[model samples]
Target: MKFSYLGDDAEEVSDVLTRCIGPVRVQKPLNTALSYRYEFIAAGRVAFSRATSQGSLSIGQKGEVPKLLVLLPLHGAARVRIGRDDSLISIPGKAAILDGNRLSELQIEEARSHLSFVIDQGEIFRHLSAALERPVHGSIDFTPELDLTTGAGEILFKLSQIMATCLGDNAEIQELPSTLSHLSEGIVNLLVDTVPHRFSAALTEGEWLPSPRHVKRAVDFMHANLSAPISMTDIAEAAGIGVRSLQEGFKRFKGASPISYLAQLRMEAAHRDLLNADQRLSVAEIARKWGFRHMGRFANDYRKSYGCPPSEARRRLPLSDA
Candidate 1:
C-alpha cells in the first residue's frame, strides 16, 4: 500500500497518515501542509512502513488501544513531545519508539525521512504473556530510553534488513504474509530476551520459568563434547539427575530433549568444523566425527537446520587461520 500527499493542510495530512498507520485515529484540526509518500512493506499483526515527509506537522491525539510505534529517522531533525516532556531526536541514524496509547505529541519540522513499524497490541500481549510465563493482564508501554538502547538499535537494524530483503518490490509479495508473521514473532522474542525489565516482568508473571541449573550444566556438557556421542543417559549422569528429571528439565529450559539437543550441538559443531577446516573433509567423515553415524539422515537434518545442504555450509565459510 502506498500514498503520496502534496500540499499544506495539517488536518488532511494527519488524516491520511492516520488512516495509513492507524489504531490511533487523528483528530480534525491538523494545521500543516506536507508532501509525503508512504509504502507498506509488510502488513499483518505487525506492519512495516517507509515514509518520507517534507514540510511541518504536529501529530498526536488520543487512542483507544495501546499502540507501539518504532520510528527510525534517516534524515532531518525533530522535536518530539510525549505528555509534558519533550526531547530532540535527530537524524542520519537515530530512532525512537512512540507509544500512542498515552497522551503525547510530535512536532516534525522541515523534512523527515523515516521508517516505522506499528505493532499490534493483542499480538504483543500474547507474546509477553508467553515469555513472562504468566498471563499479562495490562498494557505495557515502551519508553524512549528503552527504544534507543543498543539492543533495540540492533533489533531495528535487523528489522530493517528483513523488511528490505523480504518486502522489496522484487520479493515474492504473495509469500510475504507468512514471512512477516514469523519475523514479527522473532522480533518479539528478541525484545523480551534483551530487555531486563521485560525479562524480569515475564519471570515475575510466571510467563518464563527459571531453568534448572542442572539442565544448563547438561547443555554445557553437551556443547563441550560436541564431537563425542552423547546419549540421554550420559547427559543425565553428567547432570547428576535421573533420566526422567533430565528429560523434563531439558524440555522446560531448552525446549528439547537431551538427545535432540545433543544432535543439534553435534550438527552445529560439524558444520563449523566443515566451514573452517583447512583441508576438505568428506561429508561422511565429518558426520562420523560429530557422532552422526548415519550420513543420509545427518545431511538431511543439517540441511533442515541450516536451510542449505551440509556441503553448502562448508563451502560458504573461509578456511581456518590455523
Candidate 2:
C-alpha cells in the first residue's frame, strides 16, 4: 500500500508525480536532494504523497484530465495559481484544491515541503450518484482555499493525516480487504459530506431509500459464492426475482448493471487472493485459480482494482516493511 522514491533525477520525480497526481513539469533550481513517499489506497482511485524538494513546478493537462488533486502543506508554504487569477499562498493551516482538467500551476519559491492526495473524479461521481440516488450533474467547484483551522476542513485534514500516517503500522487493517474497501468509502463519504458542492444537499440529506430486500438477497448470494462462475438468471432465481426486476434493481440500487457488479466482485476476490497469496504461487497461477481465464484481461482488471500489477502485489511482503 505504501511505496517510496528517493533520488536526484528531476525527470524521474516528475514522472512519479505524474503517476501519483498529474503531469507537472518540475524544476529544481537549488541543489537539494529529493525525497518522496507515496501510499496508494485500494481501487486505484485515491492516494497520498509527500515531497521534500525545493522547486517551482507547473501542473496542467494538455488533454482533459479526469482526476482531482488536493494539496496540503504540513510545515511549509507554496503559491498556487489557478489559471490567470490572483495567486494564493498555502501554508500549514490551509489546503488547496484543484481540478486536473483546468490549467493551473503550483510553485515553491523556497525549499517547500508538503503533502497531497490524488483522487479519481469518476470514482467520486459514482459514489455520489449512488448515495444521492440520481445522476451527478456537474463538477464540484470546491473553494480554492480551505480553512483548516475549523469546521469540516479541520475534520478532513485530521482524517487525511491519520490515513497517511497510520498506513505505516496498520498491518492488521491492511490485511483485510473489507477494511481497505471501507476506508476508501469512508474517505469518499467524508469528501462528499464536507465539501460544499452542487449536490451538497442531496449528499447531506437525500430522498433516496435503501435497496429492497430482494437485492440484498441477491448480493448475499454473490458474496457466498463469489469464486463460482455464476449468471444473472442464476442470481435472479436464487433471489426469487425475475431477471427484469433484478436488472432494474441493480441499476437503481447499485448504480451499475448486474453484470458489472459481478465483474467487480470477481476482481475484488482476485485482488484479495493476490494479497494473501503465498510466495510460491505466481500471479498468473492465482488469477487462473480464481477463474480469471484471460491472463491479459485479468492483469488489467487487477491493476485497476488495486492500483498495481498483479505481480507487484505478489511481490509485496507483509506490513512489517510497510
Candidate 3:
C-alpha cells in the first residue's frame, strides 16, 4: 500500500511515475537529469501521493484517465491542461480537480513539492448511484478549480493533510481496513455534498417524507439484513422508495438514517451475542459475526450502548445463559 521512488534516470522516473500515479508518457526524457522523490499510499480505490523533484517533468496521456485526481501544490507550481483549451496553473493554496474521462497534460516545475489524491471513478459513480437510488450512466461534471484556503475546499485539504500525516506517522490506526474503506467512501461523499458538481442540485433538493408504511418497510429490510453489507440503494430497493425518501422516512420515524438504524441493530445483535454466546467466542469474533469489522470502534460503540464493555457485558450475564 506504499511506494517510494528516487532516481536520476528519466526513463526510470517515467516508469516509477507511471506506476505510482498513472499511465503517463514523459516528454523530453532523454535530455534532463532529474531527482524525483515520490511516495504513495493507497487504500481500496483511493490513494494519496507526495512528490518532490529537482527538475521539471512534463507528462501527457492520449486516452482517458482511470481515476479522478485532485492536486494540491505545496511549493512551486504545475501547469495543467484538461482537454484542449481548458488550462489552469496549480500553485500553493489552490487545488485542481481533474476529471477521469479526460485527456490531460501536466507540467511540473523544478523543486516542486505537492500532494495529490486519486480516487477511482467507478467507485465514485457507484456511491453516487447509491445516493441517488438509481443507476448513473455518465461522468460527473466537477468545477476544475478550488480555493484551498477557505470553505469546503479548505476542509477537504485539511482532511487530506490529516490522513496523509496519520499514514505517514505509521499510526496504530493505519491498519484498520474497515476504517480505510469508510474513509474512501466518506471522502467521495464529502466531495459530492460540497463540491459544485452536475448532480449537486438534485442531491440537495428536498424529498417527500414517506408514510409510516414505507418507514416500516425500510426498518424491516434493515432488520432482516443486519449482518449483511447492504447499502442505501439496497434498503431503498427493498422498501420500494428512493434513497432520499427512505432517509427522510428513517429520520421522521426512527429519528436516524437508515445506516444509523442498521448500525443500532447490529450493535444490539452484538450485545445479545456477547450475552449468550459460548465463552470460546471472543468479543472480536462476536463483533465480526454482527458485521463490526473495526474492533476499536466496535468496542467503543459497545461501551456507549451498554454502559459497559462487551467483555463486562458477557461476564455479567447469568451462568445459565452462558
Measured by TM-score, the strongest candidate is 3
How well is each residue in 1-322 modelled by candidate 2, as lDDT tens digits?
5566766576776776665565566665566655444444433466666666644444444333546777778766777877666568878888888766566777665666666766776567777656754334235666677878898778778767755653565545556666556666676677777777656655545335677889878888887877788898999998899999999998877667777777776776676677686768787777776678899998776655444577766655332222
Taking the tens digit of each residue's C-alpha lDDT, what string does model 1 give over 1-322? 4234554555566666666554233232355456766666435556677767777655675443345666777678766666665665655465666655455566666877777776655466567645642223333645464444366676666676667554455667526567667777776665555544433554555436766788767877887877775677887888889999998876665556778767766765676677676555787788898898877898787755444576765644211110
C-alpha displacement of 97 in model 1, angstroms? Answer: 1.7
Query: Which 10 consecutive positions of candidate 3 have the poorest summed lDDT?
Result: 313-322
Q: Clash pairs of candidate 2?
A: none
lDDT of 2 at 284: 77
Clashing pairs in 3: none
The per-residue C-alpha lDDT of model 1 at residue 276 equals 71
Highest lDDT among the candidates is held by which one? 3
Error of 1 at 133 (Å): 2.7
> Tens digits of per-residue lDDT for model 3 on 173-269?
5688787677777788878778898767656664222337777787778778888899999999999999999898777544468887788778867
Q: What is the TM-score of each candidate against the true structure?
A: 0.55, 0.58, 0.63
Clashes of 1: 12
User: Residue 64's C-alpha lDDT in candidate 2?
Assistant: 35
Could you tell me the lDDT of residue 110 within candidate 1? Answer: 81
Q: What TM-score does prediction 2 earn?
A: 0.58
